[model samples]
Target: MTRVFITDDHTMVRRGLRTLLEELSGFTFVGEAGDGATLLAQLHHQQVDLLLLDISMPRLDGYSALVSIKKEWPELKVCVLTMHEEPYFIRKMLQVGADGYLIKNCPREEIVKALETLAEGKQYYPAEVSQLIMQDLVNGTPKVPLTRREKEVLKLLVMEKTTAEIAEDLNLSTHTVDSHRKNMLQKLECKTTVGLIIYALEHGLG
Candidate 1:
């Protein structure tokens, strides 16, 4: 069974999720928390395979919590459960290493599927989230074109490859990989690697 924990500010939301997980076949609702700090603290002593995290909360927000989670527990699977459908939020979560993303209003079946997908060590983003990403790309296409090599690097970046891994895969020096990343940022008018990834996803480069 997939050991699961929930972190949300709303009691009703947590209760509802708990009930759902209890009824599900492949999941075990290990615990729940009202905020990120408590969740992190519990994680230290609990055995959790998946985390259903809310983006907005008191004290420690989801973004901050997620960064800490990824840094401290790299193997933990996090599926962001939020009401926000904005591209910025989704991109930020993706950049922060969320394993999956789900809107609060999404059907329960989708949530089940997302959790199952994460349990199987895969990423999940429903069609609505994907549409939003594509729409963002349509609205914000950069004028400058990328070289073939740049496109290859961008693709690997989207796949969450590190600089060294990318270099090894492409048979290039880490310096060359970094240079390509910098070039892509400048060409795409993006300030960060996450921006490049978002752009690449929007443009179907991923």
Candidate 2:
């Protein structure tokens, strides 16, 4: 049986999760809680194989729970269950090693599929989260930290604008534009124009 754990602040949400998982075979609802701390206690007192985690709760949000859980149970699989549908949040969760990411608004069937996939030791990214992953790839400008002007410059790079074009648009010198371009490429780890273009497209950068 797949031992499942449900964590959310809403009373109705916990019930709904229980019902949804109970309806599926080979899956069992081992425990549930209204916050991360309570959920952590439940897991320690009992046993759970998979966790349905919500990003927003009264105490210890999903991200924090993820970090804590991995520290205690590194192999535990966590599927983020939240209303947040933004690409940045999705990327953050995945980057932190979340087993799966799904928007709470998804159809119940997709939720089932996510669980079943996770049970088989595979990651399942709901449509919304997948789009965010693409954006992460696209907007991977760099970790070296960019000044506001440099960011503006990289945005132009995604548009395939040359240094001259960017300089004209931003009212900057060609040398300044070139400097920003080099920084963007180095920070984002992009070697060519096409690489940056693909990165922008993935990250939903304009």
TM-score of each: 0.65, 0.66
Full-model lDDT for every candidate = 0.91, 0.82
| Model 1 lDDT-worst window of ten | 136-145
Model 2 residue runs over 4 Å out of place are 138-206
Determine which window of 10 residues in candidate 2 has minimal summed lDDT: 139-148
- Best candidate according to TM-score: 2
**Model 2 clashing residue pairs (backbone):** 134-202, 135-202, 135-203, 138-199, 138-200, 138-203, 141-188, 142-187
TM-score between model 2 and native: 0.66
Q: Candidate 1's residue-wise lDDT over 15-97, tens digit each?
A: 99999999989899999999999998999999999999999999888988999999999999999999988766787787779
